[model samples]
Target: MVNCVVKNWQGEAVGETTLDLPVAKEENAAHIVHRALVRQLANARQGTASTKTRAEVRGGGRKPWRQKGTGRARAGSIRSPLWRGGGVIFGPKPRDYSQKMNRKERRLALRTAFNSRIEDLVVVQDFAAELTSPKTKDLVTALARWDVTLEKRVLLITHEPHETLYLSGRNIANLTMILATNLNIHDLLTVSKIVATDAAIAKIQEVYCD
Candidate 1:
């Protein structure tokens, strides 16, 4: 077990909590993390690119020239690939780029990503933040106090969604909010720093530490 500092919403370090290294100590953590991230990014693609094929391209009703004769390669139709306004050949078509990994692989990948950021992890002592109203400045100030900068891209993981917390961080350019249930390797690898509330940390341990 490795302990990381535990802080409050005000950014003051109150104590420390031990991290379950068994999960973090998984074999080949780095490789698995990379694979998972690649899969996640690939899966996010829209695959909307499309092009007209010979059969779909409008025209081609009649042959431009007879098979034997006026030569010029014996034109078949204006819509033929040989023509200027013809359909594309070997063009990219819409497709699913998503890659799938077994349940064990996915779990290991997530663990690896969390392991990679173990050193940069900050556990908020408060189980949940209490905010009466949406206030971006207050959240921004607290993060600044903790030295979690916007440039590094702070990712806040919570055990459950909080309306106040969500509203406050919505407009922040470099801050993002996600629940522990939806946690994935891609977001983990992209952020420079991670802040998890006490509940979230416990959830991570419960879900990933075998």
Candidate 2:
């Protein structure tokens, strides 16, 4: 359990909130978080890279020359690995890079990772109602008020999708907006600062706290 100060749109501390999520034990926390990160990165790979082997190369059936050639080295096929324009040797092929971890472990890793970043977390009131229109400048101003540095990577978590909020934040290169329910290891760990709304914090606890 952690106590967090809740700030309004103007960055004033109006109240406090608590976050209580089950995190891994200290000894195994780092290990589990690392596994989760690796799994996510691996699973995102397209695994479309492919290379043909010597046996699969075209026009490999016909021998370039006899096994006992005259005045030249013996050749088996034009597509031989030793020959030019030939198939590759020990080349990579398409494969699944995904890794598997139990659902409980994955969630534990996520909670641990999120919990580890407590110092960088910023709890804010639901500010979607503050945005009357989709204006990037106004959003920027509000983020500045919230002490969010415009140059740093910022992850904004909200309870649900707000059209104006999304549109306002979409243009900011340093800002990434996501729903609390959609939180994942990658986004939860990559950002320098996490700015989450009051409702978002509640949603995260409801969905991930077990």
Residue 83 local lDDT, model 2: 83
lDDT of 2 by residue, 1-210 (tens): 999999999989999999999999999999999999999999999999999988888887887777773778988788988888899999989999999999999999989999999999999999988999999999899888988897889999999999999999999999999999898999988899999998999999999976
lDDT of 1: 0.81
The C-alpha lDDT values of all candidates are 0.81, 0.92
* TM-scores vs. true structure, each candidate: 0.89, 0.96
RMSD, every candidate, angstroms: 2.2, 1.1
- The model with the greatest TM-score is 2
Residue 4's lDDT in candidate 2: 97
Worst 10 residues of 2 by lDDT: 62-71
